[model samples]
Every structure is written in structure tokens, then in C-alpha cells.
Target chain A: MSRVVVDVVLKPEISDPQGQAVLGALGRLGHDSVRSVRQGKHFVLEVEGTPDEAELKQIAETLLANPVIEDVELHLPKD
Target chain B: MRIGVITFPGSLDDVDAARAVRLAGGEPVALWHADHDLKDVDAVVLPGGFSYGDYLRAGAIAARSPLMADVVAAAGDGMPVLGICNGFQVLCEAGLLPGALTRNSHLHFRNRDQVLVVERADTAWTQDYRPGQRIVIPVKNGEGRYVAADADLDRLEGEGRVVFRYAGGNPNGSSRDIAGVTSENGRVVGLMPHPEHAIEDLTGPSTDGLGFFTSVLKAVVAA
Candidate 1:
């Protein structure tokens, strides 16, 4: 079985309070090396066969991510 | 007047929505997420709760549910529809409304009494209140911050479609302090606050929320 993964994150223009809170917590924990953090969602889909990039994009855009406030990226093996 | 209250799995406020409809002298019809039948109701209410267990994102799954297809079509026909809290998210995700509700800008779930100014009273849900009227209702939510493209927001503002604006401190950092909005035709209304929960003074911070239900009933009577 092949797995296709999609990562959804708030667009740069959108404010991410959850991510900002994590950054604050990291600072409190003294993780000075980390400059910033942006929170996002990750979805791993196990399909019967490796789907082409076009089909994957449709899935991510239609169901996995909201285009209004989020950006989506697909992780797939190069053909 | 019959108002259909859709109960998606994990919905916490459908009962309250029904109660509000009944209190407003309208029949409350129960609608299920999986059912295509709208039960011939004159209006529809997408009540609040973590539909689909809020999987993936709040209201995302429920927006794509089977019954939403019917709701969308009916809404297009100018049937009055109201969405509360998670219901608001569902309406946005379903393309029935513009903008999205994200995590509260403060990164916390806030629940409290909130004051709102009725900016537009022409909508199917707000006809009972006068413009600039101030009302108190209970607001409870986590991802209630509203965000939209600048141009879309400007249009919503320029057209005077904003139904409710925060009068007190902005509770969830919603852009432009918007607490609720109405469709271009004013047939659909969506808001982050729980009007259904504030119908009775005995249980809620105030009975101001009852105006929304009463307004819809009035709309039906006039129609």
C-alpha cells in the first residue's frame, strides 16, 4: 500500500495563535535556538495505489484543507 | 412556522435550538445529518457542537455531510437559515458564507457574557432588533476568530451586511470585531455566539438571544 501525505498550515497572512502559544512555551523552556513555530495539520492517506499529483491536489484542496485561511502541500515520491 | 433543527453527531445545542424555536411559537422539526429530508420546515438551524468529533477541523466534516447539500439548496431558494458557533464554521466551510473561523487569537477557549450591537436588522434573523441595538448574550468558543480576504471583508462592510459587532472587548479577536454576518440576500445568518443557549433568562446571561428566533418567525409571517 502506498501512502500520500498532505500538510496543511495557516497562510502567512493569517494569525496562528496556537502556534504563537507554542513558541512562547518553547521560550519559557529556554529553547532559544528555535526562532519561530507555525502550527499546521498533517494527513496521511493510504490509497490502493499511488495516485498522480493532480488527483492528490484535488483531495487536499477539497477535503483536507480550507483554501480561505490555509495552504496545503503534498508529500509524494517523484515519479 | 416550522424550524428544522439539524442534529449532527456530537451536536450539543440542537435541543436548545429546538427549545428556542418552540419558545418563539414555531414548530421545531428534528433533522438528521444523514437524512435528505428537510421535513418541510420553513427555516433551518445548524446548531453548535463538535460535529464529526471536530475531526480534521471544526465543522469541516459536517460541512460536507449529506444534509448540507439540501440545506445549501434551500438556502439558495431564500429559505431562512441560522448557524451558531460551530454551525458558523460549517456554513463558511460549505461555501454558504465567506470567511473562516480559526483558533481564538488568544489561543484559549473563552466563555462569557458578551455585548453586541445590531448593525443590520434587515436579515432574516435580525429583523426584531433595531439598528444599533445593544444586546447581551453568552459567547463560548475556541476557534471563533473570523478571517477573510481584505476585499471580501470590505465588501461585507460596504454592503452593510454585518449583522452583529462586538460592543465590549473583542472576545475572540474576530476581524473588525464581527460577531455575526448575513448573506447578501439576508436569508442566511451565521454567528459565533450561542443565541440558542441564551433564550431564557433563567439559564442564560440574558434573554436577548430570543430576538433572533422571534425575528425569524416574524419574517415567515410577513412572507
Candidate 2:
């Protein structure tokens, strides 16, 4: 089995409204334990066949995310 | 002149952007996200879409692409770079520009034709239009709001970096109704509107967006 991991982040200095809203909601929910909240997503896939690391990186870069506002890192399981 | 359009993962508008470039009398070069070579294009355009599925943040992931390193270097060398929507996010994420795009204040994915006033006509992307001219373009995105500190906003305004401001209603709750902006040198521009989708009148919102493409061509030729 082949596994691919995708990591993402917002561009630095760009405000994250989603994170702010979540933080507000946390305060209301009495989870004030949360000091800061930043929202982001991740994707992990298992493919049938082996694909080169470059190709997987390309896939993650082109169709998997928007480069303008999102940052991504791709990791493959070690052989 | 050849214009390179970078295609990042989740990029939805590279094809349209390339077509617009071609329609505006420039050869469109397709640049892959993994490739470091810019193929010797005169200018570069980072198109819109949900790169990395808007994961970590809009344009944040894609900004680190190997290809972007070249873009940043070239842009610093004064090669014109235009980032539309997601592309704009990438520009900001890549540190090629300032400010960040946040989610719409309404928290809804907005897609509509927007009217914007030309705030700056001296940039490579807006040179075709006169200052204060109003134009319509399509804007579709969930994270389209713009935000910056008070001092940064003041600096931008003082330096005349504001490039486009919403003319009618603010569609995405952008700060000061800002729709676009330019770098200090005026060679790099980033806007939330989709100019590529506005190039063709038959199928798109308005033809006003065509001027952006044509403007870049003129600037390149004159330079």
C-alpha cells in the first residue's frame, strides 16, 4: 500500500476569519481552554500503485490545493 | 510576448487565464508547479482556484512550490506578475506582496459579477484603463475578504498601492472595499476578481476584464 500525506497552512499575515469564529465559539462553549484557533484541512490517500515522489508532489501542488492562499507539504510512507 | 501561467494544485482558472492571455495577443506558457523553469516568459500570472483545497490557508501551501521560488525571484527582477483570486492569495503568502485574504465576513462562498473602480492605472495590469474608471468582473471564492493593520492600511493608501476598490456594493466584505492592489514597484498586482472569466462577453460576465490582459501586453511592449 502507498500512502500520501498532505499538510497545509495559510499564508503568513493573512487573517484567518474561520479561526477567529471558532475561537469565539469556543469561548461561548466554555472551552476557554483554547487560547488560539487556526482552521486548516488535511488529506491522506492510499493508492494501489507506486507513484514517484515528484509526481505525488505535483498532484498535491496542482489539483490538491490553491497555491495563492494555501501552503502544502506532501509526505510518503517510508519503504 | 510569452506569458507564463502557473498551475497550482486546485487551481481552477489557469486555462481561462491562458486563454485570456492568448486573446490579448500574448503567447501563453503553461508552467507547472513543480518545475523551476519559467520557460523564459516575459511575464507571469498566478490563476485562481482552491489550491491545496484551501487547506492550511488559501495560497499558503502553493506559495512554497519550487516554481514559486522562480516567480518570486523574477518578480523581484521587475518581471510583471499578476495574481487573480487564489493567485492573489499566493502572492501574499509568498511574501511578494503584503496583506492577507480572509474569509468573507458573511461566511459564505460568494460568486457574482462585481463593479470596481480603478484606483490605480499605472500598474502593469491596469495601465489600459484610466484612473477612476469603473469595470465589472466575476468574483467567486469563499475567502475573499482583505485585512491589514491600521498602519499598513494607511501606508498602502498613502503610497497609492490600492489598485481597485469595489464600486457598487462590497461583495466580500473586503477592507475599505478593496478588490485589488499593486506592489510598490507596480510590477506585481493581485486582485480578488477573476479577469480571465470576464474576457469573453458571449459566455462571461463582462468584457471589462479584457482590459487587464491588454494592459499587461501594452506594458510589456513599452518596457
CA lDDT, every prediction?
Answer: 0.92, 0.88
Interface DockQ of candidate 2: 0.15
Highest lDDT scorer = 1
Report fnat for all candidates as fractions from 0 to 1: 0.95, 0.20
Residue lDDT tens for model 1, B1-223 = 9999999998999999999999988999999999999999999999998898888889999999999999999999899999999999999999998899988998789999999999998899998899999999989998999999888899999998789998879999999999999888999999999888788878998889999999999887777
The interface root-mean-square deviation of each model, in the order shown, is 0.7, 5.6
> What lDDT does candidate 1 reach at residue A27?
95
lDDT of 2 at B202: 98
Clash pairs for candidate 1 = none
Candidate 1 chain B — worst ten consecutive residues by lDDT sum? B193-202
TM-score of each: 0.97, 0.78
Root-mean-square deviation per candidate: 1.2, 7.0
Quote the lDDT for B53 in model 2.
97
TM-score of chain B of each: 0.98, 0.98
